[model samples]
Each structure stands twice: as C-alpha cells, then as structure tokens.
Target: MFTHAGTLQHKFCSVAQCGVLIGITIGYTTTTAMSMAAVKRSNCFHKYGHGAACHVPNNSFMVIFAIIQIFLSQVPNFHKLSPLSVIAAIMSFAYSFIGIGLSVAKIFGEGIGKTTLTGIPIGKDFTAMEKMWKILSALGDFAFSYSFCFVLIEIQDTLKSSPPENKQMKKATAIGISTSIVFYMMCGMLGYAAFGNEAPGNFLTGFGFYDPFWLVDLANICIVVHLLGAYQVLAQPIFGYVESWSKEKWPQNKLISKEFSLWGYDINMLRFVWRTSYVIVMTMIAMIFPFFNDFVGLLGACTFWPLSVYFPLEMYISQAKIRKYSFTWIWMQIVSLVCFIVSLVAAIGSTRGLIISVQLFKPFQSES
Candidate 1:
C-alpha cells in the first residue's frame, strides 16, 4: 500500500519484488534437485558403503522438478495456491524437525565435532579468503531465511477485521517471526554443535548423518515435497505479472487474453507456453549452477537489501512521517545503512564463491 501506485517508487518496488520472486524460484529449483539427489545418494550409501561413489546427475532431477512445476503453474492464480502453500509449510516443518532431531542424535552419539571460536582455521585446505566468504555466505543464508516479510501483507489481508486487522497482524507477525527465529536458531546451532567447523550448508544432504538412513531419506522426501509446492508458490507472482502484462499489451490477441475450460480447469494458451518456457529456463539455470550454497548466498545477498531492508524502512518512514533527522528516523537509517553494507559484502563473497564453483563445475556431469 505504501508504494503509492503509479509512482516511480511503485515501479522500483515491483522490480525488486519480481527479482526476489525469480531468485526464489531458481533457489527452490536448485535445492529441490539437490534434495532429490540426496535421497538417491542416501540409498546408495546404505546399500553399498558410505565411501562408495554413488553420484546422481542433478540435471535429470532438476528437469523432473521443472516438469512438475510446469503442470502446477497452470493453476489460475496466486490466491488459488492456498492449499498447496499450506501443505508446503507443513512439509517444511517436518523436514526442519527431522534435521534438528538427526543433529541431536549425532551430538549425543559422537559428541560434538571439532569447533573453534573463529570457525574453520586457516590451513592448507582452507584459506583466510575462503573462510571470510563462508562467513558472509552464511549471513546471506540467514537473511534469506528471515526474509518472509514479503508475504506478510498478503497474509494480513486474509484476516477478519473484527479484531482490527493491523493489531491482529502485529501480533501474528511477532508470534510467527519469533517462532520461526527460534526454530531456525535451534536447527542452525544444533547442526553446528553436532558438526562444527566442517558443518555442511545442508545438514541432511551433506551426509552429516548417514546412518538411520531411512530417516534421512524421509527427511529428504519431505524437503522434495515442500519444494514441489514451494516452487509454484514462488513462481505464482511472476506468472501473474507476466500474464497480466501480456493481456494488457495484447488485449485483442486471443492467444494472450482468451481462457478455456478443460475438465473444470481454466487453461490459457499464454500461460501454458510462457509458464512452461519459464520453468524450462529456470531448470537449465539450476543445472548449470547446482552450487546450492553459492546460489542461495547470491540470491539472498542481492535481494535482501532492497526487499527485506530498504523498501520496508523507507515505506515505514513515509507512512509514519517521522520527522527529518529525528531519533527514530536516524536509528532507522543507521540500521538500513548497516544492512546495505552487509548485503554488499555478502554479494561479493557469494559472487567469489560462485566463481570458484564454476571453475570446478562441469555442466550436466553424470557424477560428482
């Protein structure tokens, strides 16, 4: 609401939101494929030995995920995705708990893995630069995790006005965000404590806990299910934007504007062609990078400043009409500045990491 429709600020905000949406789509594609690979790898390790080479090609999995998304994207619009989103959220919680539980088991069984205050030390295997990159990338991951505010407004719109929507939303945001933070911290801290400096970016996929292989497979399956729904949830905004723009631009074109019924489902030619192509392109990008950490860090760092920090702060200031240079205004500005710097450094670190990953990566490689 604060964007003030038809203004330049609205346009910029739209671009930022779209950037975030696309970034999330790509990130989900990459992660879901990895989860699929992890499930197969888990079975491989169980059947054979943990040391045996059981490499799964990520490209195939990515393509399969894209195909599923292509079918799901045909759903009329974002609001129609409520059921899928709910299911996805449930799956998310399932995997998060499983991950934490696995970590706790590891800590109890093996004791804590080696740890240090400064994190992984400078050695022949890891350099100071790499270490810095890791720290920044980790910050990026945190930023991404907490960047759920983008949907806060939409969620608030769904609440009844009997309780005062703003007040209700305030309480909801507080409770939801606090609960999420605790869960995230628990999972992160426990994972770190269980396996310290060598902690994997994805505890489940990293094979940090190989045994109880069935549980690992189940967790990975939850992740895959979550991503299946999440990929469409994230893609909906993009599809809405493109489809709306196309209709307006080509109002008379039947291909863009016409809708038909297919067994109680609304099918539009533009949506079919455009959405399918979009998924395919995203799948290819996922296959090409397939460096989960670097991609997450890059997306999180690049979008976090504008979407999660800057725009919200600016909107709040404008809405609140806080006096210029007032204490509140100044503090808000300081926070924004700090966040911007964090985003910049994170972007640089993730970029450097992505470069290194690319140097070592082979596109569509069948084996690790």
Candidate 2:
C-alpha cells in the first residue's frame, strides 16, 4: 500500500524522495548515536591520552541502517515469518500494534487525558481555556526542539574545530543538516494538509494528518527503528570506555569481568542499564502527555533556534574577523530570535496538558 503511492506519483514520490525521506529520518536518529560516539571518543582521548581516540569514522552508518530497516519493513516474507524468527516477528508486530493503537487514541479526543466528560467544551470559550491552550502550546513547542537544537549546536562546534583536511566530516555533517531540514518541512506540511484542524497528538502517527495508513505506518516504523539504532551508536562508545576503565580499576572481580570485554566490544550490562532507563523515561512521557505533536513542535523549535539560529550567529560574530556587520548575518539573527520566541510560547501553553494525561490513561477496558 505504501509502495503504491510511491509508484503512483513518481514525481513527488521519486527515488530521491524515498532516499531523502528515509535518509534524513535515519540521519536524525543516527546522529544521536554519532554524538554519543563523539562523546565516548572524547573520553577515550582523555583517559588513555591517545590522540587517535577522538578520530570518529566519517561514514554513512546511519543511512545504511535506515535503508536496511526501510527495506526490511517492506519485505513480503517478513509478514510470513518462520518459527526461528518468531520473537523478531512478534516484536515487529508489537511495534505496529502499539504504534497505531496509541496514534488512534488521540483522534477520538480520548488521548492526552482529555475526556469527553471533563474536556473544555468545543464551543465553550472561557478566558481560562484560551490562556491554558496558549501556554500549553508554548511549552510543547519549545520542548520539541530539545534534541534538534543540541544537534545543531554540536554540528557548529564540530565545523569550527575540524581541520580543513577533514572533508569527510564536513560532508557528513552537511548531509545530516540539509536532509533533516527538508524532511521536517515536507512531513510537517503533509501532516497539516492531511489532518488540518483534527490532527492526532503523535508526530508520526499521521492520524488526522494523513489518511494513507500503511505508508505512514511504514514511515513511522522506519523512523522508530532508525532512532533505536542511533541509541546504540552512542551506547557502544560510552559502554566500551567505561568497561575499559572498570577493567583497570578492578581486574580481579567477576562482577567487573561481566561488565567489560576485551574483544568484540561487549557491554551487555551497559546496554541493559541504558535501554531500561530510556524505555522507562519515554514510557513515562508517552503515558503522561500524549500531546505528541505539541511536544514535537516545541522541541523542534527550541533545538533549531538555539543551534541553527543562535549558536551559529553568536559564534560567527565572536570568532570571525568582520569588516562590517553583514546584512545576511543580521537577518539570520532576527529569524532565529523569532523561532525562539515562538517555541517558548508553544512550550508554556502545552505543559498543563501533560498533567491532563493522568486522568485519560486511567483504567480503560482491555481487549481480551
């Protein structure tokens, strides 16, 4: 079903779009891992004092992972799995089930803890509700950029620090940024056009935003899987470094033995701890405030504004020897300031609603 749309309008759905959308989605997720890896690499430099430790491989690992996941998600035989892969199959099934199920919950005005009974009446326009909505939107809007802006800031730092010979790093960072912006804009536009005023709370669910369920599902799954892999990129380096240190600290202990491995870079303990933490934190967020769109919107704005807008301009002003203040630079600053303001508004407006979810997720009937 998803493939059909790609085929139907090859222009809007060309190989480039497929590649761009999937690549950017994966890049965004993968960059998190890369950032983690960079952090880990920095640690390695600090601990062993090896200059080579900070040398991160400038590769398209994120893109490869995204492509593989996208392809696997569409494989016909995946739906008809053998007994050996039952667990894998079931995990995939579970993702689809929960992903779509939670997405649908928002459309009926049921998600985000707002019930038909207690929700502000659609036609009832009290001064309180208006103020509440604005503040909630502000908070959510700002928070949405939490992850995004960090990446931008990191990229700027990298670009400024990298030697001119490190062309590969520059290329990779450029690809990551350019692709991400395009993807975000396209997805946001499509979602708004499709869902209009009745969009769902989730970012990728495409509930009221887009009707092509299977395509949207595939996209969401690809995105989620890509993001999951990204977690590993960071985890591996941190765990590896920690394990190395632990071995040095306690060479004879069996507990430390299990924690570190000299070969294959095994770090099961670290994986378990980090993944458990991630799941717990994300689940709390999901359960508490399913107003995903507002959350995403705010986060995006905050992140992009700080990194892309503020950090870049600030750094440029401080670092570069200027003959005069360029109009382009001034214009960029203005744009970033506007984005920051908008995001702040969205975040404050939406925070009240996170509390609202406690009431919504209260003991609903379970399907047997």
Candidate 3:
C-alpha cells in the first residue's frame, strides 16, 4: 500500500495525496485513541507533541537545515571566497556531518539509556557528557513531541466548536494524535538503530531513514518547501486576526489590497514573497546555526517546551469549559509541569556542555 503511495508521491501529486492520507489517518486515529482515552479520562491530549507535528511536512527539512546552519554561521573565518556564499555551502557540508554525529548519539545513546534507566544493563563506560547528551536528547524528543500535541488538541477543539461531542470529531482527534505518536516512536527507534554510535551532531542526523547524500539533497529541497508552508500556516491566522481587528477598529483601512493577497495570501504572492522569504530565512538559519545537533537542545527548550508543555496545560485547564479542576486536571497539570521542568533541565545541561566544549576548545580553534 505504501509502495503505491510512494509512487503517487510525484511532486505535485505528493502534496495532495499526502494530505488526503494524513487527513484520513488523523480522522481515524483520533477517533479511536480519544475514545479510549476519554473512557479512562486520562490526560492523553499532550500539547507539545501536536505542535511538533504542525511542521510535519518541513520537520525533516528544518531538522536537517538547522544542523547545517549551526556550523555554516561560524565558518567564514576559516576561509574566504568570492561572494562569500560558497563558504556558506562549504560550512553546510560540515554541518551535515556534525548533525549526523548528533543524531547517532541521540538515537543510540538515548535508546540505550532509556533501556538502562528502566533497569536494563546496556553498559557502564559512557562518559558523563555522553550520558548527559543521551538524557538531554530524550528530553528533547519528549519536548519536541509535546509541541505536536498542542497542535493536535487545538485542532480538535477548533473542529468541535460546539461542545465537541461529535463522534467524527473525536475519532479524527484520536487518529491524528495516535498517528503522530507512532511516527515519532518509529523515527526515534529506526534512527537509533542505524546510527548506534557514530551519529550526526543532532536529532536531524538520527532520522535513520536517509543516507548523508540523499538526506542533504532532500533537506535542501525541504528547506524551501517548509519555509513556504510554515509562513502560509502561521500567516493565515495572523492575517485573519489582523484583518478582523482592523475591520472593527479602522473601518476605512478595512479594504485589504489585492496586492497583499498576491504578496502572501494570494497564489502569486505566496509563490513569490513566501518562497523568497522562506529561502532567505532558511539560508540564514543554515548559515547561523550549522550544528543542528547542538541546537536540538536549544530548540527543544525554547520552541518545543513552550508550545508543548506550557501551552497545552494552560489550554486544557484554562480553556476547557467542561473539564473542571478535578483529579484528571490536577494529574495532567502535574505531569505537564514535570515534563516542562525536565525539558528545561535537559536544555540547560546541553547548553552548559556546549559552552564548556567551546571554552575548552577555544585555543584550538585554528586547528579545527
């Protein structure tokens, strides 16, 4: 079935086909999972996990590009070239290697740690930093996944605007959530299996499915696509709210120009400005933070944690009309709080380690 799906994923057809499949998958997965979760009244509607999924199409690209960006941003002093852009591309290659290492460490290291943390004996020779990285990576994963959960819950709530008791909506929610969870687990497992020890510098390298050459190539393409997609998704709500607010406050300015639509909301504008901005931002990020592996910790702490752990609980407790501050609410809140704390600690640890590494290697900069 997936073979056929892959064959159908030819450029333009891929987007439409993927959307249909994703929608169908979300619809069914949400229904079943939510139904079961509702029966048990478990706080399964994690927010972060969903937020991560919001960038599903471009997650791969961001993961890959972010790693490259970390290194590329610093490589200018290493060598000078015409236009300076060539140096950026060179740095990107180095960044890819580092990202691979990080990914390897994350998947294998974290996978082994999780096993041992549960009382299984994997090994005892791991260094303090290695152990720390493993733990931090797992925390990053959870945090990353949590953001995706936020998106899921919000989507469900929006879909079920009136009381949200419809069977179809519930089913869709369950399916979406479950699908995301499964995809995450599989990616983690497969990546860990492949990289074992010589992983990329970050989670992106640990994706496990793609080799370095293909990964980079695909990532380059995805960078462009993702930026466009993200802008579209994020801008829509912004534009809607802005337009609405403007209409109410300044009736004279309520007349939105057709050019603005062409700039973004319109097909021509979307293809032009969004595409250009997407490339520029991605290029900048790639150049800035070339070491995606290092950034994973930061990204998880800054972006993922806020979206997943913080927002979801706030949404559930503060927004849910029927969900009073009962046992479920309290338990969910506690869990969310713990997850956030853990994410913060892991991020701090990773950052500290990186800082120390930089400090120790400061004198050896030219050698590197």
Best by TM-score: 1
Q: Per-residue CA lDDT of candidate 2, range 234-328, in tens?
A: 22333345557777888786765664554654444533454344433433333333333444544444344444445555555555643344886
**Model 3 Cα lDDT, one tens digit per residue, 1-368:** 12222343333332332332222222222222222222122121133332232212222333344343333322312112232333333443443444445456555555542232232233677666566566775565466454453344234323535555576666766766776676566655554454544433323322332333334334433333332222223223323344455556755542432233433433323223433443345444433333333444545554454444544455455556437678878788788778768877867765766565556543212110
Mind giving the per-residue lDDT tens digits that candidate 1 earns over 1-368?
44533488787778877887787788888888888889999999999999989888777888888888888887666546456656766887898899999999999999998999988889999998778878887878877776764456345534676888889888878877887788889998999999998898888988888989999999999999987876766677678878888899889999888888889888889999999999999888777787888888888888888878888888788888889899999999999999999989888888888999899988867232
Worst 10 residues of 3 by lDDT: 36-45
Which scores higher on lDDT, 2 or 3? 2
lDDT of each: 0.82, 0.43, 0.41
Model 2 poorest ten-residue lDDT run? 15-24
For model 1, what is the alpha-carbon lDDT of residue 183?
86
Q: Model 1: runs farther than 4 Å from truth?
A: 4-6, 149-165, 261-265, 366-368
TM-score each candidate. 0.93, 0.46, 0.46
* Number of colliding residue pairs in model 1: 0
Candidate 2 lDDT (Cα, 0 to 1): 0.43
